[model samples]
Each structure stands twice: as structure tokens, then as C-alpha cells.
Target chain A: MTQNPQITPEWIAVDCSATQMRATAMGAAGPLAQATGETSKDLEAALLCLIAPWLSAQTTPVIACGWDAAPFRAVPCMPADAATLVDIPTEDARISLRIAPGLSQTNPADMMCGEETVIAGALALNPDFDGVICLPGLHSRWVHVSAKEVVSFQTFLTGELFSLLSQPDDTLDGFDPTAFEAALSETLSRPEKLGAKLFSLRAEVALMGLSPRAARSGLVGLLIGTELAAAKPYWLGQPIILIGAPGQCDHYAHALRQQGITPATLDAGDCALAGLSKLRGLL
Target chain B: MTQNPQITPEWIAVDCSATQMRATAMGAAGPLAQATGETSKDLEAALLCLIAPWLSAQTTPVIACGWDAAPFRAVPCMPADAATLVDIPTEDARISLRIAPGLSQTNPADMMCGEETVIAGALALNPDFDGVICLPGLHSRWVHVSAKEVVSFQTFLTGELFSLLSQPDDTLDGFDPTAFEAALSETLSRPEKLGAKLFSLRAEVALMGLSPRAARSGLVGLLIGTELAAAKPYWLGQPIILIGAPGQCDHYAHALRQQGITPATLDAGDCALAGLSKLRGLL
Candidate 1:
């Protein structure tokens, strides 16, 4: 929304979501610079605003994941890497762009775009790694990976529901840990009462003098706890790696620890850059 | 929200909600006239706008329910009647305003404002009736009425969630029955998968080409089915009465029928008037 600073590098890696796009300028050594655009419509215009200075006449390549038009590849396949990129015709002659295809499952009808690239980077770093991978964000995914291939996955609407229920101005800064843990345990035991439990927050505020912080925390715990109940099979005993923002991963880690799972975590941005770098090697 | 039409009556009954207020004028025999205002924030002004002609020097009594400030009485109590009315001093001497208190439950921390008056009307019409009462609205309630008292009740956020997830302009006229019933059955059997099932609607649109109508129907079925799954104890083999908008009651009836229960029903507006009329008897 403000003036973007210029950054020039050999290539670029961009991860796009509905509300934001983050680009990492990549040099042979590693990430040389970064830029972010908090925008939705006219992605090309937004990207140009942030990354135009990096373009050159040498035909600089830009690899992107999470375009709305990206094809969804059926699961029981490998994570999207360089081979999955489809050439995108652009107005700029100096820009050569391609987007990595996302993944889809037919039975439960699940889809995702950027998380696959992160999974690719994780696998690239650990060639023989196999287990469950949770990429938490607006839509959190629990993916099953084996022998460098994504077997199948499920997506939970917990993050989206939390956003919808909480006040828009809320940033989860001063949430009550005690209220959160209490509500978490409550929902984990009585997941059936989720519908009723949601309304109680509003009632508690009116009748019991519940603070907004506690209510927000209770909402988070209730949603995540119910998700944990449903996703029991996914994380009950599986070796898990949570890939996301550090704060988000910490919340998930707390819940998983409650269920007796010690999950290793990787920074989502780092994995995205690593994944794109691995793809760049192929390009 | 339109030009006033003049008609005089003995007293007025009103059901006030955040979005709309419906007022009914009562005569010696039965209802005489009606007015509605689709507005909020200024309830006294909205009421006067709709019923100013009916107010006169004799000091017309206004029996109102569902005002936000109405106190909530605990359960194991009869529906709100004349005794629940709390007087409000107004600027005009012609208006004697009173609001009937709603109901609350302590353990679950639930509250209701308008539905209690509707329940009172249903009870007034059938003094000996004892069973479950379902009031379907934005925040639906299921009540356990036994021996002329509300033994306990539960509130479901299904309707609110439905409105939240649905397109603003959609009226649910063209929803797919097959998809609705199928989704209902799916959640009735496996309600734990609700968090995943919600996201599936969006995924279905992309990967499966699910029509918006079908998606909307699926959402309704999913929420209702999950609520039914949780509320099995309330409706399983128990005689039931549904009091709300006819269309909303019909939807609840359809799902109840799947569980092999047929419910007796009442129009919500009629019940609100009958309730207020019953309360007016004491005045």
C-alpha cells in the first residue's frame, strides 16, 4: 500500500495468498532481498510495484506458487517442483514467469497451492523424510508424505473460522493462556458441543463479564481443539513437522504437545525460498 | 420504513430484533393491524414511526419484547409473561412501554430475548402441553418444556453460520435437495469431520465444479446435520413442537423427519402476539 523499495537479484520466488504476496530475491548464494504486497486484485500490478526493479533484459525468471488459475494436480503424486511450473505469457518482455501447480483430492474435495512448494523444499532438504506435514495458515493442511511423494491430505477451516468469529481488529496479542487451555480441554472432550460452545462466548461477555482477550482465546482454543479431535488420526502418533510462521507454529505446537506429539517446525518463508531455490537449480 | 397508515387499537405487541421490529395492534376480538420497521439503534423512534396514529390521550399500552436490555431469567421457569414486564418511561405520556424478560442458563451461559415470548404464547395456547420446542431463527434454540416450565435448553449457531457462509443476496430458493440431504446424512453419521467438511464446499467449487446452489444447500445440510447429531438427546423419541418462521420450521422438520420424528409447529409472529395478549390480560 506504500512505496516499495527496489531490489535486484538473479531470480525471484513469490508466494501468493488472497490478501498478501511475498517475494524473495534470490542470488546464487541465497536470498539477497525481499518485498511484500498486501493486495488481492491485479496481482501483476501489485507484483510489478514490488519487484519491477529486479527485472532485467537478460530474461529474468520468476517462479510463483498460489495463483488462482494454477492447475490442481491430483494427489498420490510428488510435491510441486520446477517440473510443475507452467509458463505464463506476460506483457513484459524481460519477465519469464511460471506458476507451480497446486494439489487436489477427489474424495473430500480439498485443494491447496503454496503449501506444496513448502513441502517440496522440506523434502529437498531431507530426501528420505516421510510423515505428516502441517502447513498452518488461513487454511491449515495436514499432508501425508512418503518416499518423496504427497500421498493425500486434509484441510481444516479452523484458521478461517477463527478469523470470521473474532473481531477484525484483533491481532491475538494478549490472549489468555489459562482460558485458552481450559476451553481447549473442554472441546477436546466434548467436541459435539462446538455449535453451542461458540455462542457461549458472546453470552459470557454479556453475563459473566468475560474480557475480549479471554473470549478470543476461548474461540481459538475451541476451534483448534475441535480440529484436533477430528484430526486425531493424522497426528495421534505420526512424526509431524509443522511448517508456518513461528507464532502460528507455536500455538499448534502447544496443542500437539498436549496430545503427546513433539513436532519439529520450519519457518514457512524459509521453506518457500528453499523450495524455489531447489526449483531454480532445475531451471 | 414507509408512509404511515392510520388504524386505532387497544394495545400493541412488538418483537424487536437487531435488524427488524415487527409490531401488531390488538383489538377486543383478535389482531387488528400490523407494521414493521427494518431498522435498529433507535427502537423508540422506529416504534413511533410505525404506530404513532394508534397512540392517543387515553395512554395506549405497548407490550414489547426482545429489547436488548431485557433481563434474562434462569431456566426451570415458565416462559416470560406479564410478570416479566419491566416498565420504561418514555417522553410521550400516551405511550406506556414495557419489555418482557428473556431466559438464561447458568452452566452453559446461554441467553435469548425474543424466543421466550414466542414460547409463552405457545404455552398459553396449550396450557397442558409438555415437550420440546424448537425456535428456528438467526440463533436457533431447542427447549425442553416439562410441566409448564422450561427445564433446560440449548442454542445452536447453525443459522448464524449459514448466513455467514452464504452469499448475501441468496434466498435459498433454488438450493439442491439431493446435495442437501446427502450432506445432512454425511454429517449426521460423521459430525467430527465438520471442520474439514466446511472447507470442502470451496474446494468442491474449484475441483468438482459444484454449483453455488448445491454448495449453499450442502452448507445448510452440513450445519443442521451436525446440530442434530449433537442434539440427539433433545429430540430422540420426544414429542416436539417447532415455533418460528414457517419456512425455517419446515427445514428443521425435514431434518427431524430423517430421524423419524414429526413435529407440531406454530407461526412465530402469531405466538409473539398470543404471548403479549396473554400478558396484557393481567394489565
Candidate 2:
């Protein structure tokens, strides 16, 4: 049998956000040929400049584009609205571009935000993952991906809520995060009087004059406990995979393990890169 | 025999929320003419109807405008700032008024909410009250009233927080509230292992197929515990006066008593009304 000829494909990955845009170029072998990132409020200019460098490298047939966020892209339509690709301009600035369908939920019409793409990308790296995936930060997302698709997800207002609760205003402020982390660790160990401990924030202030930091720590503990309560039903008996900040992941992992749930975390960027690489051909 | 002339003062009580206005014609001997009440959203209109009959009957200066919400009476220098009034129009259309402010802080900028009216009202009934007054609800307010003025207060998003944590959208729909209340009562009986019980929402769903209602109840317990933690600082071994829902007050009373804080609950409306009545002259 004659061996099939090798074909090099030009590809681009556009990761868009409210504040910035990141774009990457990849070869057929999934290696980054060139990368561009820009911080701008306007995504249109960012996207145009992001893919401009890759166009001159090689004029390959059927250029593939891996796009995320609300940035525009085009592809051919398939049956039942699946893979329904639209048209893209074939100008020098606007070459071939493709968009992958991020996780979409109807009924309420809620969709994941920027960080979720990275999370979805992470899950794409491990197709066999069958558990809870926690993306921790100010606005943490817990996405459930199974059987080649994102099944359901929930967002915990952990970071922002903590900020608001800890710092009611300028006069009031938060204490060291270590105190919060320590309280979290201790609360997880017992996991019994967690609520009582949470309620103690105001009590501590009233009784012991808990500084803004301590009050903030108390709030952090309470929010974490509340989030755990919310996530329990969805993640019961399932292993947890965390992405995002290392310290936050460690805290959550410690908390989860104390509660007898297995937890594992990986770097967010690596997952996105791996996911973008694998989907290069399709893009 | 010589006797000081008895002075009866005319009084008006305005409940903006309920859209009810009341006026009592008085003399030094106490209420001389009939007191009247009318239902109206317009404060001026309601007041006219309530006091018009009394005004026609006799000529007496309106000693004071006792109103619950700040909008009922407009005094230029009394409050100094309208923004400082704690109780205002609620979201509900049916309730046409807000809670009024009691005493002002020396800081000028420092002022408490209308719930201060309740504490004042409670004190009007029990002037020697020296403890924590917990106004539990969606926006739980904890006030430490000392020497007839509110010394300190804090707000807790306990009820709203609980709803967000347990119910979380329409996912846990069609939940029976009765069963949840029972479970909540059971949880309240033993405050030692509340954290475990709080987390048990997920456990129950997994192990026993807990219904949405049961999960909601678990959330309430968690909120109570969290609220307790926040209020603990201000407790200062003072008695807890629950000024909201009777059932909730009883639950909190039981919880606080277990934690070694004495608790007493009064009629929520009575406190609100009395608070409004006491502030009638100021408004």
C-alpha cells in the first residue's frame, strides 16, 4: 500500500475576554507556530491583529480556526443545526475562521463565561474524567462533563461574595487570608459545627473586637461552607478535579478530602493549550 | 388640694408598609376622642382621612407625626439626612411604607434603620432591655441598643444566602416546605454537630434521596449557624430579642439558648408598630 502524503494545516485559536484577547497559531502537528495576545476593550481589532501574523507564514488550503467567546467565526451548516457553520470573509485581515460551540443550556439561556472555555478545554484533555471539576476564583465554576459533552454546571460566588461580606465598606476590612484558610482547615476537620463557627464572625467582633481581617476570614469560611452545601448534591460521591489558583485548589482539595471525596487539580493553561491543540484539525 | 394640670397629647401612628394610618385624639387625661385608622398608600391622603374626623370634632395642635417610614413626615432638621433612614419602601406594592429611624448617633452620619423602632418599641414595653435584639428575616438585622439609642447594628444576608445555597434556581422545585421545617427543627435541637448536618444535605440526597424541601431545610439550619457566628461578637452575654417571624424566632431562641445565650421573642408587628409609635414625634 502506498503511504498517504503529509499535509501541513494553518490554524488559529482565539481566546476572548471582556478585558483582553489571546490568539495562538498552530501547525498540523499541534505545536504553537506563533502566539499573540493583546489587552484591549475592543475585541474586533484584537482578533484581527491576533491572526494577522499567521496568514503570511504559509498559504495552506482550508485554513482552520479555533475560536472561543462571542468573537465571530464561520463554518458550513450540518443537519439539525449541528455544526452549522456560517460564512467568513476571505480578505487579507479576515481569512478562514471557525468557532466551536461552547457549553450552552437552554430554558434559562445561561452559558458559561471566559474561564469556562479553559475548563471545557481541560475536560477535553481527559475524555475519561467522570467527576466534579472545580474552577476556583472570585467567580468559581463547578462543571460536570460526561460522555463527550458538558452535562451541567453551577457557579459559586465565593470570591466576590467573600469580598463583599468581609469588607462591608471602607471603614470595615478583612484580615489575613491565613486566618481564613486555617479556620477552613479546622472547620473541614470537624465539618460539624461549621455553621456555628461561621455565625461567630459577628459574635467575635461583638465579644472580642475581631478585626476586619478576622471578620473577613469568618465570612470566607461561611461562604466556603455555603458553597460546599450547594455543591454537595451535585458532587456527592464523585471525585473532584480543580483548576485555577494553586493555593485555592489546595484549600478546596484539603476540604474535599476531609469530607472523604477524592480531589485532583491541574494547571489551567496547560489544559487550554492541550484542548486547542487536539481540536486544531476540526477548527 | 392642689394638682398639676393633666396634659393629654394627641398622637398619630403611621405604618407605611401596611398602608394604614391611625390618629388618636387625646387630652392630659389620656385618649379623650375616638382614634381612627384608615388604609391608604398615600401618606398625606391617609393622614387626612384618619385625622380629619378628629380635627372636625375639636381644635388641637397635631403634637407629633408618628410614622413608621421616613416618607410619612418631612422634618427639615430632625433627621438631617433622609438617606440615613433604615426602613423604607419595601419591594412589595401592597406594603406602602418604610421603617423609620429612632435616635441618631453623635457621628451625625451614623444612624440605624427602622428596626430601631422595634427595639424602641420593645423598650417602650420593656424599658430595662439590655441585650441583643435579633431582627431575623431575608435581611437579618442585629442591633445592640444601649441607653435608649442603637449603639451598634449589622446586616446579615442569612435568609437570602440560605435560599441561594439550598434551592439554587428552579432546580429544586416542587419542594414541600413542611418536611423541611421538621428537619430544620430536628437539626436545631442539637447544635453540636451542625456543620455535619449542614453538609448532610448532599449526604441525604445521596443516601436517602432527600427531596428538595429537605435540602431547603438543611440550608436554613446552615444559615442560622452562619448568622449566629456573625452575631456572636455583639452578643456580649446579652439576651436575644427575636423580632421577626414567630416560628423563626422560636427556632433561633432554641438555638441561642443551647449556646448559652438567653433569648426572648416579641410580636414582630407589635415591635414594628410600637417602634413607629415611639418615633411619631420625631417624624
Expressed as tens digits, the lDDT of each residue in B70-146 for candidate 2 is: 42221113221224444434333322233444433321112333445556678877887776788776557677766
At residue B190, give the lDDT of candidate 1. Answer: 79
Which lDDT tens digits does candidate 2 get at residues A1-283? 1222242236565655444455655565565544456556544455656555445545432222233433221111110122433334445443555444444333212344444446556666676777668877766667676654556666655665555445455464334656666666554443434434444555565445567666665566555655675567656787678887676676577567656777778986666555555455343
- Could you tell me every candidate's TM-score relative to the true structure? 0.96, 0.49
| DockQ score of each predicted structure, in the order shown | 0.79, 0.05
lDDT of 1 at A133: 94
Candidate 2: regions farther than 4 A off: A1-9, A28-41, A49-92, A106-110, A113-120, A166-207, A211-213, B1-117, B123-139, B142-155, B158-283
| CAPRI accuracy category, model 2 | incorrect
lDDT of 2 at B130: 72
Q: What clash pairs does model 1 have?
A: none
Q: In terms of docking quality, how is candidate 1 classified?
A: medium
Which candidate ranks first by TM-score, i.e. highest?
1
lDDT of 1 at B169: 88
